[model samples]
Target: MGTFSAMHYRCLMPHKPSAHVRRPTPQRPMRVRWWLLWCAMWCLCGAPALAQPAPKVLRYAMVSDATTLDPVSFSDIYSVEVAGSIFEPLYRFDYLARPVTVKPQLAAALPEHSADWREYTVHLKPGVFFADDPAFGGQRREVVAADVVYAIKRIFDPRWKSPQLPNFAAMGLTGLNAVRQRALDQKTPFDYDAPVEGLTAIDRHTLRFRLDKPDPRFIFSLTGTVAAAPVAREVVEHYGDSVGDHPVGSGPFVLASWRKGSQIVLARNPGYREVHYDEEASPDDAEAQAIAQALHGRRLPMVDRVEIAVIDEEQPRWLSFLQQGLDLVLLPGTFAPVAMPGGRLAPNLQRQGIVAQKLARPDVVYTVFNMDDPVVGGYGPAQVALRRAIGLGYDNDEEVRNVRRQLGVPAQSLVPPSTYGYDPALKSEMSTYDPARANALLDLYGYLDRDGDGWRDRPDGSPLVLQYHTDKTLRPFNELWKRRMDGLHLRIDFVPGQWTEQAKAARAGKLMIWFLSWNASAPDADEFLRLAYGPAIGGDNLSRFNLPAFNALYDRQAEMGDGPERLATIAQANRLLLAYLPIKAHVHRLQVSLHWPRLQGYQPHPYLRPFHAYVDVVPNPVNP
Candidate 1:
């Protein structure tokens, strides 16, 4: 799942320092004629002959700090994006592909799967070495198949309580779940040495995964965000709970320093293998082709150091970008109207050598009502009516136009556009905003103003206040929500808190209502649907929706291949979501970014977390 900042911004390319040649000091000052000739040559060539190059440092900013850097416990996309560079997933998506396609990462090539698609065998590339850390006793550590085995076991260790555990349900490894269950049942530490029938390290450079069932989409889990990224056992053991502070991996970059909730710095991994930059792209896609031509045969991670700072406020973040403190800035929606008016960069900004990338993110933002909360929870008709009325009362179109600065499309369903099973032609109550209809529904359901305090009460004459939990930055959104609820004579009170705390509270089902957004890690629309699945309530299904019919349909669709029948099943499931109103999908956000012209390979792809690896910061800031 993608985090909020990951949804909009990432990656600032690096600039290398120029090396100055010591020419015996021009100890003797040049004569007037020679100096004049040198000035003429400089004017003609447009570059000084002895100028030193800029240091290859990429300075970037994200709205929030990463909650942690441990791969097994990575909750938000910020953590995923940062840890991704330091860790080695067996596979990743092709960099320039429109629809995401699997590509080898630490693995030498794509895995060979059995005909039933229940098993996969991967061959790891030899010579890949983890960055040197104290955990390794100052010795080089080559990533092995055993490390992959150990990495997978960490998720099931029961100590991490990994939010990523729910993702493994789709994997259905033959004996892994049994080990997890045994630990849960006996209250014993997970036995990492237990011989699991599914996971195997055939050799130093080989891994084999055996599944209990067919899962053609299982390959996507190896994208490093899910479960299979290789983390050294010793590093995790050495750091213990503090492993998030010291990530050791066999990827492109190594963590140099970190100040929690402030800044993180990564230096190029000296142990990184000799990998060249190459990306697959459609021949007809000119943008991809151009990026390919620009970065052809360059070394991986052209940047020597990446400094990511946490600058949460929009105004300061924009100001920092304008003042050239940041090499690139992900445009917050509030400034979209001015920065990229009418879907193009402002001419004034464009003239300053600014370039922009507009991407249609495969994601959805929605309001989640806790189904287990006393005020909003229950399967009763009155509870359902309360939710439906609230869903109908809120104006998502207004949010898109005003709050989002016309940077989003009001969602018709949870499924985002440009992904499998997303139907652009379908329409639903999710896209409509009618206070009148909402009032009638509430009135019919006996949610009246028993106390006559200008706000309607619950059906049982209880106060009907929606204690909405959100970040302080959502004032515009909260104002609109309060106004909409006021129109329906319902009450809503905002509770502002830190994003990390609110997210924790959300997972524990301690909040009545909160805003949540999800970006697809893979191309499947099923990822969005998992948010409403009954069994995932404590995990991804924060809404705690447990309708039996909907649950049955979710299971049915999960088992089927991506075909017309599965699409029909998914559409039917969405109807139940609207009818029950556990979550109200508001929009599919548009990600707009602004970067300097010197930042090469600037295309933004949400699926690619290690974006800094491909982009390069040239010595010349004005041009690539």
Candidate 2:
């Protein structure tokens, strides 16, 4: 039960020092002369002594296994974090910089935008090569502008059915939509070779995009690795429908080995283009300044390998980090008190030289009322009243204090703080909690107790029961909700299932109500607002909310720059969402990460996926 023994169970290689052998010194002058002659001969040969290899593996754990490796096929945060290492985007947020700044990753520099914001031109960096694979036919292919074009075209293909297609579809590309419709109508495979005037490759390294309408935030969309990463045509053709299992990209790391539902190993990509660690931290942050000084000019991918174990339970994940079986762990809210008592590092952890990084994430968790479900769905006055009543009855402030342990902020609107277009001064009906008003609304909207059953019946006199889909992990929160619903005489039932299953059910419009969350992919409010857009119903819009007024405001704000006009449009959209009550926005959870002192250059990014290109691990000394 020691740390080293625990590491064996997690498939980690423990250090074993070499045994030392000693020889007696020369006792006589003759023996001394013989030893002196041997030393002289050894020095003349110029041989080097054996030394131990430096530690170069970063072992970590995740709360759940990644569902897919395809960058565009899934929208989950776990999958996106893994795909980010295998795929390279045109731009990425700087690792140590505050206030989120994007810098060129695969591109040579920032894209050139036209005055009207309808055109963008990007130039790829030379010498970038994809990982070696059988699909290349033993030929080394360099990344080109056509590769980027082909990747974007795959998103529009019906066969792949990328979940992030709406992001590109909203751009109003000149001829892209027509090609997509043709493929859909003919029931044939998409033509990747077909020339789309809107997406053109001017040269081997230059790619240009032409939009029909003005889009100031179009550049931010390209920063996502899911839709913007380059994909080789031959790789896709060879892998066919199983392309997600075989990811090949020009990134810092390549998928070396994988054991599904167990562990994943990533090794440094030898073919990756030359890149170095360079960033600026806040002037007042001493810890950040110290880390920057140590890794300012080092070559990227300081670690030679990365091993991630799938530890679904929080207790084991926490123990793994405590025992040094894992290098990093994001502390769960339930264990915050045990790990960082009173919002400070625990005494035992501090004695062990463990460091904790706290951050306010740009994310929101909410319960979605499926608009397609007859029980809890619609924009009518009665449906809105019911949803508002439930929203008001379920006190988020209590949930934060009891369940979250004061680790989150109660959300006022869907737009999280620190993002563009977020209005801190705006108040909405869902932000308030009043059980008295909730009871009155339910009673006035036709829900009443019939036959002295103690439970209220639906307006149509059918047995009223609201089914909520959730997992065992959220039993505490579900119990609280059940108690609140009982006070209103509303019967409730819990549907227990895994997170993946519930996500699929929600997307298929089979669930009545479900708890879900969204983490921002960019610093703009457009990323969060587009989740409820009408065109994204089958994709990011799990609630299936479709309001023409909200859509109009969303579209208008998409074209306007960050200013008073755009802020006003965003406020209008928020009002529409609040009025309809498609979802009950909950809270913005705080992120707390714990790691060993040896793990340096560790920074938390609200939106950017963890790439670990600049992270370096110092080796611990072996016991003698």
Candidate 3:
């Protein structure tokens, strides 16, 4: 392992020819026909050089395959950024991971909520434009308020049938539930019949949303990638099924092209505006300054073009990075700090480096046991006994230190660190590995090895076979689990399956035991509640665990206005989830990323957030 060279040592100098010379005599006649070109060439020769030269292109890799390019359809981080580049969102999470401010390119200001917290009003920034539309023969149209209303309504449209319907209640629109009910009642054409009393088109520049209940995080919910973006109504209605392939958005980057499973290309949007504007400067001046900053330093869309190459495997990407084939390799959370060739990076910098510099952004990893197994009687004695035993047998501290390379903190609560209202008291309840406690629980629950065949049996003389539905990624953890269970005469069956099949089975509640982790949006309790206690579509609640008390707190949190009341409610929900032990909170896993020295402004984001921007990347070559 080597420490990266301190970034300060790198120098930026513009490349300039050592000497200037007069043009060749034969070229003089050609200049007569192109006088403007000749004059521009002469002026360039006299001008002073800059300290830094702009990069022409950016190339990077995505770990997970993008499910879709449609913001309304995809939920993965990769898809959001891919779609985000093409579609402008009303707001985006700030560097601190708070949804307090607007991105400004699409949204002009933070949404204003009524005193009752039921209604929201958003004013559009003037004169922002989308990508050139073929329908309009390459003419860019100014973004309007109607586009905002249409985008939100499209989520609930029966024709679109988006998976994001449940989240719309946060916007105070209750029409989706009615549409869902009508479908269940065998009604023809499950149209959105309920008049959305909450949403109003207050002219063409202002939009308002009225909620059925006072939601403290209503505005925060609207800040989601799906709701925050504005869609062209004509494109959506005209293209119909083909809209995703030919989408339109008002973001900093436009979708130049996408080659499925190969690469996605993006180009700068000419009409883009800065969210952070100098009030004294005109918008045109600000746009020009933004372009200059983007092409220069500190802030960037640093390159003229961006190419996101699709690379599924990590090792190949790592190999390419070592060979200098890649500009940067976005490492997933799986890899830890490893030795690198000193020649490639730097050797002496490795041994004395700060631990924080080598690690990834902190995130939690959890293992959820499926309590609703057909053989286990759905959270009955067998499943509870197994979960209790497993909880008491595994050493979380050791896993955090050894397996995760001390890059993570042991987590006992579902709520991750750095989030609002995360309680320290919740840490006390996590159970460490205690064989005696595990054995006692199993013994008390009627598990005994009466047959003396090295396998335990239940009170009814049936073998206590523990089946774990896992993937290859979890093989090491599975081995540890198997070894630990062996001491208690518990037979562990490691069932292997493809990742997709295993995930489908887990979602359907067909798996006996499985692993689950909430890669949260903001480390909030609501993030966990949505997956754990919200509505169970299938086996997603593998533990078959539900507490009305927890749901009540979540509901109360939704009803209560933002501030202390809501914060307390969230903390209570987190604490309750920990107490119930539905899932073992392992530790907050850090995302480890690698980059070439040429790249700059490579700040790490929280968890799985995709913060790719050409404005923020630059090369660190010792010399060109």
User: Which model scores highest in lDDT?
Assistant: 1
* Global Cα RMSD, each model: 10.5, 7.5, 10.0
lDDT of 1 at 6: 32
User: What local distance difference test score does each model get?
Assistant: 0.84, 0.83, 0.61
Clashing pairs in 1: 15-55, 15-56, 16-54, 16-56, 17-53, 17-54, 17-55, 18-53
Off by over 4 Å in 2: 1-49, 52-55, 621-624
Lowest lDDT 10-residue stretch of candidate 1: 6-15
Estimate, for each residue in 46-157, the C-alpha lDDT of model 1 and write its tens digit: 4424556655888889888888888888668788778888887888877887766788888898889998888899999888889989899989989899999998888888
The full ranking of all candidates by lDDT, starting with the best, is 1, 2, 3
lDDT of 1: 0.84
Candidate 3 on 156-192: residue-level lDDT in tens? 6666555455456434564545554666577555443
Model 3 collision count? 21
Q: For each candidate, how many residue pairs have backbone atoms clashing (under 3 Å)?
A: 8, 0, 21
Worst lDDT run of 10 residues, candidate 3, spans 6-15
Order the candidates by TM-score, highest first — what do you get? 2, 1, 3
Task: State residue 368's C-alpha deviation in candidate 3, in Å.
Answer: 3.0
Give the alpha carbon lDDT tens digit for every residue of 1-624 in model 2.
223334333333223335673444554865676577666655554435567786499889876667778776777887787878889889888777778788898889999999999999999998889988899999898999998998889889988778778767887878998899999999887887778988999999999999988988776877855667998989988998888889898888888887888898888888776688888877888877877897888988889888999887777888888889988898977798888788999998888888899889888999999998888998888888888989999989888888888888888888998799777777667668888999999899998887579998878888788999887778779988999999888889999887777777777789999988899988889878887898887678889999998899998998898899889899889888888889889988888999887777888878788656878788672310
